[model samples]
Target: MTPLFSFLVLSLKFLSADCKTEAGFCSCSCQKKELIMKAVSILTVLSAAVFGFFVGISFPVQITPQLQCGILPCSSGDAANYSFSGTSMIGILWSAFRNTNIQSNGTSENHAVTKPKGAEKLPPGLVVTESDLHMRRLWGSPKEDVATGKYLLALAVGYSEKANVNATVHKFSDEFDVVLFHYDGRTTEWDDLEWSKQAVHVSARKQTKWWFAKRFLHPSIVAPYEYIFLWDEDLGVDNFTAEEYVKVAMKHGLEISQPGLDSTRGKKTYEVTVRRNDAGEMHKTNEGGRCPDVHQRPCSGFVEVMAPVFSREAWTCVWHMIQNDLVHGWGLDFNFWRCVDNPEEQIGIVDAQYVSHHGVPTLISQGNGEQEGSSEKVRARQWAEMHTFRERISNAEKERGNSAAALEEYHP
Candidate 1:
């Protein structure tokens, strides 16, 4: 107690004297204490921040569907639907396939398509083949692709794209297996597509408003397609598939199936050339039955090449009829259908499955309609020839059921 108590008393006295002296200098001792405390607290916060740099605190990030396609949350690799922001991908791929198919990307499957590789170049049982078309377009190293039984129901335009043909093909893609064979000269490079891998090199059937429906059959190479679907390219197709076409034909036992067609200027399918009676007066019903008779269901005039689906049997029946008597490159479809007689010979018309005709000439406009500016007079002459052929076909059908009568005459 003597030494310890003596030291403790001295330390307490020293602290008390020091505090009294400090308090004399600053009368607000408690306030000073708070200021010092706040400064120390700030310093402590700063030290904690510095330490946190070395040892970080983790937090979660919000993952969202903001980075997706078509308003759908899709994974990495699945092929999903997308809106196209650029030019036609289908035309580009088709052109690329035709160009490169024989050089670097010659498809082996296409080569082996013909049953006897030595006998023919393509598969058997083709109804219409325009294999000669490869020569029409200045293709030196043109490649022939045997279709995987996929047919393109096309309808080309005349004078211009008055039938909305391009738009029809674009929308038809969602349902039907179609190939829009356009004649615009802007050849595209299909750099992004993988055509050599999966897509079959389709040398499919092509029909056009001007070519098949309006014009006569041109000398074609791919014309041997088992069932050439000669129709209007501008025809609309609502919720229809390739299989549905086959199903309708097979189910109905139809050799020829003519779907409903729309006139660009009107609401329902309009009648252009009508039938006349013995008095030469145009009748609601023509002798050849241009528009369907009242007893018959209201129907389209001619085959509506805009949406005509021909079966193999029908093809065999009507092909020879048009092939022998093709006046020009127009009026072949109607003339061919005129030959289809057996009321049993069916041409299925699915009005529900529709497509719009008279497309805006986007492709043609983009290409500036420059076909080497060949010969204006020559072009005019050719157009006149085409329309003349169309008139001849309409008149012929009025007199005789084109294909039906032709077949009977030919066979009998």
Candidate 2:
């Protein structure tokens, strides 16, 4: 029997006969049939209005743009979290939307999707479409793989005979993103090599590495990477592996660190930076009588400008300090400890993987050859720049009511 008829019959039977509910409430009525009919009519209209209101308030969700996929409205499922690969965002969306057993051309179709549970409802004044989400994924805003390695190697090359850029690229290519900042302006020669083709190249003529770095390797550009190896081309890494160096540095918690320099290659002034393989990954050595605060000493809070490796946090601060006009980076190393916190423990040399300085002195030689750039002239300009940097730092410290540490040393 129809629900309405059965209800009507039951109502009539209850009206005609004496009835008692389980709780002992008694009622008898026959004149209320007209009243009951009016009540049902009111209920029917109210139900329709409520249903229409719900549908009106719902956010319009577009799962599939192309008819190639299924068109069924979404249901609750775990399919939205599934991983899939495709060139187009639509294909990726299709993968997440698809979970139905129904097949189209041997592929299971997900045309019928339900509203995902816990999905955020659209708020007022905000409009997000399928295309917007797709564009975000296509660009840099996609989901990040937290487990993936985050390191990069930035090499500065001038095609100079003594630099050996190609050999360095081959040595650490697998451990990091080997990027070539070509200062020679010739892009054609690197096109022949497979590694060169894979690497990111930034070209400029006769400019130093710091110039390219100031423009391209900004904190924003290298934000995704955890560590950046801002290295010169002349270093010999035959005794080191990039992976081992990083491991040791990480273990020791060094933020601004570098491989210990082999002092035999050149005249070494600071004894702390000299390699010592006899101890742990990092030795507790320092230039005696320096850093009265017991921290910020050489080989602890300081690393040489050449082949310096900076952690992401340290690099962000260092990038802001780099002057656009000062390309040589002559006076920057002395102030590097200011960028990091607890530099004594957070910065140190990794003696486990040391590199030999080829001692080419390419930048000084190149500048000296220029008409306005004799070695004496370059030295004077460098000193002026360093003096300016010191003045700025001093002013900043004075404004903050904090004293900045000055370079100190004592002979044994």
Which of the numbered candidates is closest to the native, going by highest TM-score? Answer: 2
* Model 1: residue 386 alpha-carbon error in angstroms: 5.7
Off by over 4 Å in 2: 1-149, 161-163, 173-175, 287-296, 368-373, 403-412
Candidate 1 runs further than 4 Å off: 1-147, 150-180, 189-227, 230-233, 261-301, 316-329, 343-345, 359-412
Per-residue CA lDDT of candidate 2, range 1-412, in tens?
Answer: 3775666676666556644563433223333555477558866876898786555434223343222224463332333334221123333334445452223411322322222333335332243221100011234534651232368888887667323777676667354666778777767777777777657777887678888888888776777677899998888877778888888988888888888878776435466677876766776457453544445445357787888999989998999999888877766777788887777777788888888888776656556364765767766777787677767777877777676546423232
Each model's lDDT comes to 0.40, 0.66
What does each candidate score in C-alpha RMSD? 26.1, 13.2
* lDDT for 137 (candidate 2): 26
**What is the clash count of model 2?**
7
TM-score between model 2 and native: 0.60
User: What is the C-alpha lDDT profile of model 1 across 232-293, one tens digit per residue?
Assistant: 43445544445555555566565665543334432343332211123121112223445444
Clashes of each: 66, 7
